[model samples]
Target: MIVNQFLVLGALLFSIGVYGVLVRRNAVLVLLSIELMLAAVNINLVAFGAFVDDAAAAGQVFALFVITVAAAEVGIGLAIVVLIFRNRSSANVDELDLMKW
Candidate 1:
C-alpha cells in the first residue's frame, strides 16, 4: 500500500499510453491510448487522496470528473472517427486530412 508504488505504476501506465498514442496510426487505438492515459491519471489522483490527510475527498472527486470527461470524449471521438471512416473508407490517422481543401 505504498504511495510510491502506486506512483510508479501510474508512471508506467502513462508511459505506455504515450507510446501507444505515438506509435499507433489507427484512430481506435489512439482513442484507447488516451483512455489509458486518463486511467493512469485517475490512479495517481486516488493514490494521493488516500495518502494525504485531507478532510475532503478532492482527489477522488477530481478523478470522477476526469472519468466523466473521458466518457464524453470517447463518445464524441468515436462518433467523429466513424464519420471519417464512413466518408473516407479508412481510419488511418495519416490519411485523415480533412482540411486539405
Candidate 2:
C-alpha cells in the first residue's frame, strides 16, 4: 500500500476525532474522541516509519509509547468523569464547574 493512503486515512480519522471532540457534550465521548485522534497519530507514525525503512523501528516504538500514554489518559479521564458524574449526576462537559472557585 502507498504511504499516501495511510496519510489520507490518518487525516480523515483525525478530522472526525476533532469534530467529535468539538461537538460532543458528553465527557466520555470527548475522551473517546481524544483516543480516536491518538489512533490517527499512531497510524501516521507507523506509515512514516515504514516509508523511512528505519532499522530501529522508531515509529512503532513511538506508537507504542503513545498507546501507553493514551491508556493512562483514559484511565485517569474516565476516573474523573465517573467522579464528576457521581457528584453531579451528569456527564455533560458544559456542566462541569469543578475548577471554578
TM-score on alpha carbons, each prediction: 0.93, 0.93
Q: State how far residue 101 of model 2 sits from its true place (Å).
A: 11
lDDT of 1 by residue, 1-101 (tens): 57999999999999999999999999999999999999999999999999994899999999999999999999999999999899999999999676687
Off by over 4 Å in 1: 98-101
What's the true lDDT of residue 8 in model 1? 96
lDDT of each: 0.95, 0.96
lDDT of 2 by residue, 1-101 (tens): 57999999999999999999999999999999999999999999999999998799999999999999999999999999999899999999998765887
Query: What is the alpha-carbon lDDT of model 1 when measured against the actual structure?
Result: 0.95
Q: Residue 52 deviation, candidate 2, in Å?
A: 0.4
- RMSD per candidate (Å) reads 1.8, 1.7
**Candidate 1, residue 69: how far the Cα is off, in Å:** 0.8
Q: Where does candidate 1 have its weakest 10-residue lDDT segment?
A: 92-101
Candidate 2: where is the Cα deviation over 4 Å?
Answer: 97-101
